[model samples]
Target: MSDTTTNGAADAAQAPQIKMNVLAQFIRDMSFENILAQKGTGGETQPDVQVQVNLDARKRTPDHQFEVVMKLKVDSKAKGSGDQLFLMELEYGGVFHIENVPDEQIHPFLLIECPRMLFPFVRRIVADVTRDGGFPPLNLETIDFVSLYRNEMMRRQAATVPADDSASA
Candidate 1:
């Protein structure tokens, strides 16, 4: 090939094209605590487990890319004494390079696939935290990301709708 043609090909290859891929996947931060241990030592009763899950998503850039992060906090307490037994928090995220994808594709990527990718790790953390706390290892039930996402959207929509007051008036 001629020098000019070869140079043109090189330029094309180096051009910043929209390539979609997960750049990094990991637990950005994690915390697990055995709260009951602070109260006393030895022969403590099993605590009631309470789990709280929070879901959030935001665009990292105005362009066709985003970051979806799921934060889960679990707290277990002794029912009678209200003494905390275990506390765990997991922050997980996936960096998605989304470009030129249609609107339909975006929802599934953010709401469904992203959470699915992060769940196993979150599950493992929960189980380990309980086991480490000296309780039987807790197994978290599987989460339905699609249903959760849809319910969230519905709740937001419902909140925005103005209630009819004529009946009360």
Candidate 2:
């Protein structure tokens, strides 16, 4: 009994503790183009806006640090002519500290949880940039990271699987 207890205590001391933190955050890239500015001043009606979002994350050189980025591209066009009114591109990223997580779980943690923490900041930046570009503030809707991750997983799997022509023949 005494030997077992001593061994358990020794094992506990050697195990790394689980922890995570946001070390830094920044706007990696930002661009706002009022495409209409160069064109003649014509009375154009309200423009329709389309926003696209993409996410990427990677483990940093250090074993426990990671970088997560959210990229947004917003294009606004005149409803009638389909002429671009404005084009905005934003890339925001954060450095995160994560320790003692299992290797199998790292991808999900970085893709889902890390992005959730960083989304609000990125959203605010997007809104501010649009407002500054002579348009109303564009607030982005909340994203479901879990669903996005699952869909991405499915896409990767589908890409790897070769299409079966055996059945058709």
Candidate 3:
């Protein structure tokens, strides 16, 4: 064979075969705190709690790898006294292997499927943390990941749309 053809074949053979495999899957780390529950006494003071949930995901590399983390913060206080009763924060995350997927497919898997897969674990962590913190288990509301991701993409696209006749043309 000609040198050019031989070189082409060799390059193809050396090319890294990209196959996505879950090299490892586990909770890298976790933290849950309930300082208020520890400090105050159990009373019939009708406590009120405000809870906030934040979700975020990021790609660790250009290849098939990503991390999805969910965070929950709950602030509780006595209804009348306004004294802090309990504060709990739970942070949980998961690592995913996503390889050989085209750019178009990557977004869906990263935004939708990865979060869906990680949600149950994160939810469980929240519940367990709250229970351990001497409060009723926190059952998180179910998330519609696909819709959430699509809405985010649409919002971003809308924000970047050129604003004027000149730009449009």
Residue 33 accuracy (lDDT) in model 2 = 89
- TM-scores of the models, in the order given: 0.71, 0.80, 0.61
Residue 110 of model 1 has an lDDT of: 77
Worst 10 residues of 2 by lDDT: 160-169
lDDT of 2 by residue, 97-167 (tens): 99888999999999899899998998898888888877788888998999989999998888766455444
lDDT tens readout by residue for model 1, 29-76: 788887667756646575787777776667786576678788888888
Ranking by TM-score: 2, 1, 3
TM-score of 1: 0.71
User: What are the RMSDs of all candidates, in order?
Assistant: 8.5, 5.0, 8.8
Q: Which parts of model 3 have CA positions greater than 4 angstroms off?
A: 1-22, 25-35, 38-41, 44-53, 75-85, 158-169
Best by TM-score: 2
Candidate 2 runs further than 4 Å off = 1-18, 42-44, 163-169
lDDT of 1: 0.75
What do the candidate models score in CA lDDT, each in turn?
0.75, 0.87, 0.71
Error of 1 at 25 (Å): 1.6
Checking candidate 3 for backbone clashes, the offending pairs are 64-98
Q: Please report the TM-score between candidate 2 and the true structure.
A: 0.80
